[model samples]
Target: MSRPFADGEGKVGTWVNEFKENQDVTYACLRPVQTTVLGKTAKVYLTPFSLNDYKLEQLKHSKSLSEKNSNYMMVCQKSEPKKTCEEILIPKMKVIPSKAESTLQKLSLGVHDESNKPGHKSPSAAAILSADMESSDEDITPGVDDFSGLSPYEKKRLKNISENAKFFASLQLSEVSARLREMIKKRQPPKSKRKKPKKRENEIGCRRSMRLLKVSPSGVSLPAPPTAPMLIEDENPLLPPGPLEMIPENADDNHELFKGFLQTWAEMNKTSSKNMEEELSSLKSYKANLNGMVISEDNVHKVTKGSISSVALHPSETRILVAAGSKLGQIGLWDLTQQHKEDGTYVFYVHSQPISCLYFSPANPAHLLSLSYDGTLRCGDFSRAVFDEVYRNESRSLSSFDFLAESAATLLVGHWDGALSLVDRRTPGTSYEKLISSSMTKIRTVHIHPVQRQYFITAGLRDTHVYDARYLNPRRSQPLVSVTEHTKSIASAYFSPVTGNRVVSTCADCKLRIFDSSCVSSQMPLLTSIRHNTITGRWLTRFQAVWDPKQEDCVIVGSMAHPRRVEVFHETGKGVHSLLGEGLGSVCSINAMHPTRYVLAGGNSSGRLHIFMKPGSY
Candidate 1:
């Protein structure tokens, strides 16, 4: 059988449009004929923007009338509504102009009844002739100096010689001249230095050497080589020689034996000198000691912070929310929202949690991602808390979880059983297990790539895995991408929304490293390396790092450092942004104030939860 659109005999009816143009509705002779050429009724022509302004105005008016009357085309739609996008666009036109109206066409052939100028290939015979003649008559004669001497003709030749010489000298090419007479004629006034081309690197170096070495650091003339002193090979380098002796190659003349002796002595004094300089600079600058922060901001306002498990803000970042779960399996969600109304009193009791994990669902406003300590992932409705239904999985432990805002059906969970499960939340009762890790090490963090929601990027105890969710729904096995960078367990891995190709990982070594998600290698180097301390068993898992919502170059990291520290890394993503001036102390979490930016709200081992708003000026 032939395809649906194929004409009989397999000859495509390319003139179907022409055939339709002449056809008219003939339902028992009730509908009349319609065609623009006939100039009867309201007829529109289909062309490259055949709608003149006047025709458009008429069509719009007709459309409005049809809408108000609900009689004309509306009846057909009601009978058998055309629901497809193509069907809806049939009566509309978003016309692209023809060649004649395009810029280049308009330029070549001027508008307003002018014959558009022919393009270069069509240059006129007359134009070509004129150009040829002009070049032939004026350019090839020998230098006029060939005719220099006495009569009127001779004087003219002499004047020409002087003018040509002056022109060449203006270009500074007179130095290339070998003839004495031409050189004499070229004696024009010297040109100003305003137009010199910039000097090349080697030329610049040569010039600097000639001008600088002639004077010493003390402003006294020095012999050639401007003093390359014999630099003592300091085992511990001393205060980099006095400011005056700090010149390049500061050592060449000292005897090797003496240089060695000086090096040994210099090493012992380096640390003391460094300490003195640091103390001096610290004394001069206004220092900020953020040793402690009030984590439970206005402790009275806190909803019993120690029991708090989850906190997130609206996509708009206008509010803050917190969820606390008690040992009694009770979960409580409070409006710890930062907007303190001077006049309004609190109404209380939103949602509570004996929560295992709180995942804010970005795609659906009415939903949230919830993990019960019982190994169940529930889709909690915003309106009430019984949850739509229980999604129980007993295969492995649901250790941690995260959600993707772009996909309406995905649920990503991390497991202590060493599996990263991608659950289908839409049909929660009949949960579809999209992916379960094949590895044996439990995953610590599960993050789904927003740009590719079908890909679950999970951090396993030993490696990071990127699973293509399409593998699950389609029953296809697209090999997962596993990156092993962290020496010990890979506790966390996050990809920035600004650029999907980059990701960061933190691990047991108390170090944070960045990787190009596209390439995972033993030689994968970090763009930024940060270490916490030397303490053993101090897993980096206790800390959290979040990308700055307002700037792609900045990342807010919470550290296990004593008195705690929130390191703000700027330009660490791409060298374009530099690190910031201050760090946060005792911060446990960085969450959105609203969906736009975040306030690092965290507490320390001291049982405090401080809310530090990102600096407004940043």
Candidate 2:
């Protein structure tokens, strides 16, 4: 058997056989012709027939065929055709002139052409040589385009150069010498323009009146100062000048212009469905006494501590458990139902360092969680009458913690080292069930949304971050939202009990910022910020602004601007009330509201507890 192979030429073919191994394979050239095969037109190549040695011997051995029959050639098997040739490209060296070189050439040609003109005289060889061999010390001028993208500094330097040129052009030789001498002299420092300080608030109305004394030939008569425009009522052409409806004698009748007043009034009345509406309505009434709640001088209780760090009121109204934590690691418990005697209060030493935060478990009212700077988180169970250390680590200091409403046994604790750990009470032997590195700064406080237990917020030294507890994993590092509007350290961040849509954070920048957390934006929008005085006391602890559980619109924060007072602010940034008196002798930086009652308690730096009650409360 022989096989045929196609070479570079599509028409050339070579045949190889085992019997002719020593002989060179014969090749045939074929001509391509276009012909119709089946129903399609195609190109076909046919090889011409030719008899080789093998075919000649076969004819001689047969002895029956003529030499004409020996002319027959056998066709070999079909083989593939050679492919088309491809074009090849080779790179070559080429010279291209830059813009600067081309510009220089053009300039040189123009100069040469000008010199050769009939009206121009050609320079001497010496002068031409001198022009070609420029001095190395001479400065090179820049092109116009070079100035287009000059930096600000370069542009300023150019402007100064232009100004100096103008100045020199306007000055004489003597004046120039004098100016140069002056410039060479040591420059005197520029005088600072000091701004006059604004007058104090108390001096605004006490300014002395300036009198105008006129000397009318006798120097005795003084005319009144010139008067400006006075306010005068005029008739508006749009409104007919009829006798004004004084007080609307017919109370039920509505004017044509104010016909929608009744509809708006009805719509407003329909919205007064919640308790918040009633509270707001009460404040609007003339008889309403927001000041009915005040710290009485006789109601002050003193604790044996230097500074009160935190305070929390129990959720029971009948039997109030006012727990106050101090920097001396003492927990002062005062039973408000008992008499105001020294022996009536119970004090306990639970931590070695100052307390940071105190929270009463919502699931178990008898359980009180206390966090201290000593890196211990203990729960004082009233039902068991014992205090148990829930968690403590020597390396990581516990700053704050809150029970997750999603699971009562699950607690979210914030550490001083910027990690938020999820502690499962059921499995206490293991370390943190899940730890999340929320920030690079220490977490100051952690608060769970009162309504959405699955979501919690951690107030770090840098910013406040909101995370979903359900989606929290040890590997998860991102939060749902981050609020960084605070310019200083966030002392505390809390969600309103009535509605979790609003979050209030007290910042060390002396501001109480209210944010609308319910907004769909990535960052919650700040509703309002109230100006507060957080730096009044050097030794006093920072105040934490807490939302009144009774009214989400009201925020209560310790007032440092006043000698002794607590300020209450509405979400509109208005000061609604202030509990100020001589009883609060020092600055009160820690305050807590009675969860179920309309009572308030504040602790000062000296550990004096001040209590305020509503009307009729003894």
The count of backbone overlaps in candidate 1 is: 29
- lDDT (tens digit, per residue) of candidate 2 on 1-618: 343322212122232243246433332221111011111111111212222211111111111111111111111112123421010000100111133223323333444544454333333332222122121111222322243433322222222223222333333444555676677675867789999999887764643324423545564666766997875764211122111122221223335422332222122212113344243334454114456666666668876365899988776644545778888777777666655444346566777678888877766666667888777777776544456766766567788888875445878888888887887777655435567777447788898887767788888885988887767666546788898898878888998876588999988888889999875236688999888887755687888899887677788898856466788888889888888876677777888887546688888888888888775564
For candidate 1, what's the RMSD?
Answer: 39.5
Per-prediction CA RMSD (Å): 39.5, 35.9
Give TM per candidate.
Answer: 0.43, 0.53
Report residue 488 deviation for candidate 2 (angstroms): 1.9
Each candidate's lDDT (Cα)? 0.41, 0.59
State, as a TM-score between 0 and 1, how close model 1 is to the true structure. 0.43
- The deviation in Å at residue 567 for candidate 1 is 2.0
lDDT of 2: 0.59
Model 1 regions more than 4 Å off: 1-296, 299-301, 304-310, 323-332, 336-356, 428-430, 472-480, 518-525, 534-541, 571-594, 603-608, 614-618
Pull out the clashing pairs in model 2.
none
